[model samples]
Target: MIFSRKIPLYEFFPKEFVDIHSHLLPGIDDGAKSMEESLDLIQGLIQMGFTRLITTPHIYGSVWPNTPEIIRSKAILLQEEIQSRKLPVSLSFAAEYMLDEKFMQYLDTSSLLTIKNKYVLIEFPNFQAPLQLHEILFRLNSMGYEPILAHPERYTYFENVINNIEELKEIGCLFQLNLLSLAKHYGTNVYETAIKLLKAGVIDFVGTDVHRKYHLDTLKKITSKKHLKLLETPFKNNFNLW
Candidate 1:
């Protein structure tokens, strides 16, 4: 026997939800390719009832190499366009830093950009755990930045050692789940892990991590009741800090 049910994502995804993760900056990374596309994505988010957006473009050293100046400059240009068009949404910029050697150098010599001057969104390699993961989180905390580990459910390294997530939380690391993962956009394993984390109450925040229109479309197709209920938690989404 086989059975299935579907629920519209919009039914559970609050229109007022504050989105703190996205890549709508044009020509910066692997997200929007041009100004027009960026505007289109922003407008789409507005139509979806999102009141605020903190678009975080990737700051991978070898691939993206985006500095705070570069990101803010592009954001300023985008902001001007949004104003001229009178879009009814608030937008801001932060960077998703890859925990790599280059980032360590930045930690030593430069000030890292953060979300709302408090939270820092960070990521690791999908397939392997970094050698100095604990040290990095400790340093981030010592520097007064709340480190939010982006998409912990997507990391295969944690598949066999899921308990490590609790260890991370004990040490002040917050987990930001990718909204698409709940919708099964990545795969069954990711979707299952997302649900597990949600059930465990380890998910602190959720984000679109949207790179294009299709990502938004996939989110709209999500029909999981459990995923909707998980959103009810006090996810620092609308926190005044952002």
Candidate 2:
């Protein structure tokens, strides 16, 4: 569906919505520790009124190393199991790629994980922004992929240099905001930073970024919070998943 760039936020979002970021793929990454746990998490999301989920399993370097093959296989398994149970929620696969040498090498070789294979979801080191990020982003654009920075508000390195977001955007990066950040799940600082981005209209999409039931539980609280009105504002695109 088409989205108007100037549409009000409330007008842009339907009561039911699409959650684009999640880690519900079973036995992958730190989310949904097992198949049973993954099913439980998606069921909870369904209860929360989300109809479509693009679950992004982590593809870190040393820690939660995940490949597209692993992600696709897991996603297919979950799809089959969910169908067998007759659950109605829709699921898709992507990866939250850690910005590292392995990923850079892959990018050079024209291989990377992305949502819909159009936007690559990437995260920087939490403590410091990488020096080569600009070059990497440029290369991604040249390769016909958009880089989506995940949870920009949670990075402490950005606390003093928030304008870096504008620079990233200028360089063709899209930003994905974690809904829990609006509820102070990370901290009051993160919540405030999230609010700033929301008001600025810099966030291109929102996601649960859910790793487990606790996250969904916290999301319930976030859905109730007042500042959620920022998200209630209309998006430019009709991303109404439900």
Which segments of candidate 1 are over 4 A away from where they belong?
Answer: 1-7, 234-241
Alpha-carbon shift of residue 207 in model 1 (angstroms): 0.3
N/CA/C clash count, model 2: 9
- The alpha-carbon lDDT assigned to residue 87 of candidate 2 equals 92
The local distance difference test score of each candidate is 0.85, 0.78
TM-scores, all models, native as reference: 0.93, 0.89
lDDT of 1 by residue, 34-125 (tens): 99999999988887667788999999988999999999999999999999999998888899999988988989988888888889999997
Clashes of each: 0, 9
Per-residue lDDT for 139 in model 1?
95
lDDT of 2 by residue, 199-229 (tens): 8877787777999888877776654334545
**By TM-score, how accurate is candidate 1?**
0.93
**Candidate 1 weakest lDDT stretch, 10 residues:** 233-242
What lDDT, from 0 to 1, does candidate 2 have? 0.78
Error of 2 at 48 (Å): 0.2
Q: Which candidate is the best by lDDT?
A: 1
